[model samples]
Target: MPNLPLTLGCWDYDRVQALMDGRVRPEGIDLTFLNMVVEETFFRMLRNREFDVSEMSMSSYLVSLTKPDRPFVAIPVFPSRFFRHSCIYVNADAGIDSPADLVGKRFGCPEYQMTAPVWIRGILSDHYGVPVDGPTYVTGGEEEPNRQEKVPLDLPPNFRVERIGPTDTLAQMLADGRIDAFHTARKPSTYDGVRVKRLFPDYVEVEKAYWRDTGIFPIMHVVAIRREVYEANRWIAMNLFQAFREAQRLTYEGLKETAALKGMLPWFNAHVEETFDTMGDDFWPYGVEPNRATLDTFLRYHHEQGLSPHKLSVDDMFAPETLEEFVI
Candidate 1:
């Protein structure tokens, strides 16, 4: 029997390098790995259902479920995760000395529903006591202009989402103090230390403390399959999941080969060791079971921020094929 032909749209990550280079093919799928930045991939996938499978914004994927047009179902393959403490940039003159000061300020993000901002907003509210509904959210492009949300949202009236003018980009707005704070995945070009600064300049220590206090390593993206494709070919889910897992396994093994230092970092192995000490062996775990707390927290954030109609469980977001693996 011939293998199913599928295309996966995702960013160029070390974990999925094997898949892109044709070294680790899915068990029975001919995967054409479409390499692109996440924004393009997400915009295309959400707008047109462009690929058979793709890295989707986790927050947006949750919102998709509430829409009657249930376009996609995801496996528990997370291609991107980040500690979002460094993602918050604020105008130097905005008088936002701390998170609490951010209340009543104009906060800008690329989209009200993007995953990075969702994580940033949640973290600030939960840890810093800056209410989630406090900031008047300004939404538009970060570098370009007039960027729109991937999915249409029907948020509650209390949520204040105001759009920037067609020509206004959040990057420029933050520099000009038109928006007091900017939270997005990519750092804006205006992030000069003097004009635009991170809310926590010492974000490394702060993020470490955050992890120590709360075991939440924020997740940004998940690999999702178009519902039409998934419904017709259910077995493809596990095949792809196992393939992604194997690819990550290779990357993890590569991260430890300190014989000559595989990466550019001089003390790469030291950092890896420190990471292992802080997080466990399988630090960057990909599965519903290990990530239940993280996913559940994100679901709560999605619901609280009004991006999701209701809080969804781990089972609600992932394909059942990825929930467990057979023991040898």
Candidate 2:
């Protein structure tokens, strides 16, 4: 067996390790798992060059798309519910009530430009009639100076914004009463002397409604491979995708067991279970034929938001030949 170097980035490192160890063999491929993030960081310090391997991290993956050189055979992992962002938590001591009470309250977030914050602000502006535009709304990120950007013009004018550090800081801020409320992507188990009152559930609900209304699903993330890598080692790429598919299938069937084994914190476990229950069926089929509806929805949003230089066709995002193989 030729040892293959595969890098995986996820919150549940142990679960992935178990899968690779054949404790939970999905597709019979036992590729070696490399600690890419830690290794890459260390190598970069010594040689000032990045360690080259297939890198996978949901957060970093989006930034990867903006790179001109993209991979060709990245496989889409399981689809998680869209509600993974923009939760509203309040200090247990604080008497903050509904979304309307957010006025004059300080909030913390992971990033202002992140999808969750943007979506949450949009919902508050469009649905709840929150005035996000003025000085009353305060949000901050970890980055220095805590930059704030105007909500998209299409969104409500009153959407105030700020940046905060990571989710933990946000939780802490809420707990310490430094912020009356904080908005972040929190699992159900997150507790920092504060309690999550309401997350923007409407984010997922609205996404589903949009899909039903327009047959378009929001694109949260993508699995991309560099074109060059695909040409050189198509077999490995295909095998990798098969492994991912099998893993996803196993995850779906063994949800409860996987959750326990993954040692997901209580809040995360419930959140994962709920998400799987809701979006499990919509997970893309393993074979080629990418979910046209989902991709189209994502592209449409990307185009409308001017995020992409040009609208990408289905072929632009997926390899047609690989997809054809999966078609019945």
The most accurate candidate by TM-score is 1
Which lDDT tens digits does candidate 1 get at residues 1-328? 9989999999999999999998899998999999999999999999999899999999889889988978999999999999999999999999999999999999999999999999998998899998899999999989999899999999999889999999889999999999999999998999999999999999999999998998878899999999999999999999999999999999999998878787888899999889989988898999998899999999999999998777888897888988988899
RMSD of 1: 0.8
lDDT agreement with native, every candidate: 0.93, 0.46
lDDT of 1 at 318: 84
Please list the residue runs of candidate 1 whose C-alpha ends up more than 4 Å from where it truly belongs after superposition.
none
Ten-residue region with minimum lDDT total, candidate 2: 42-51
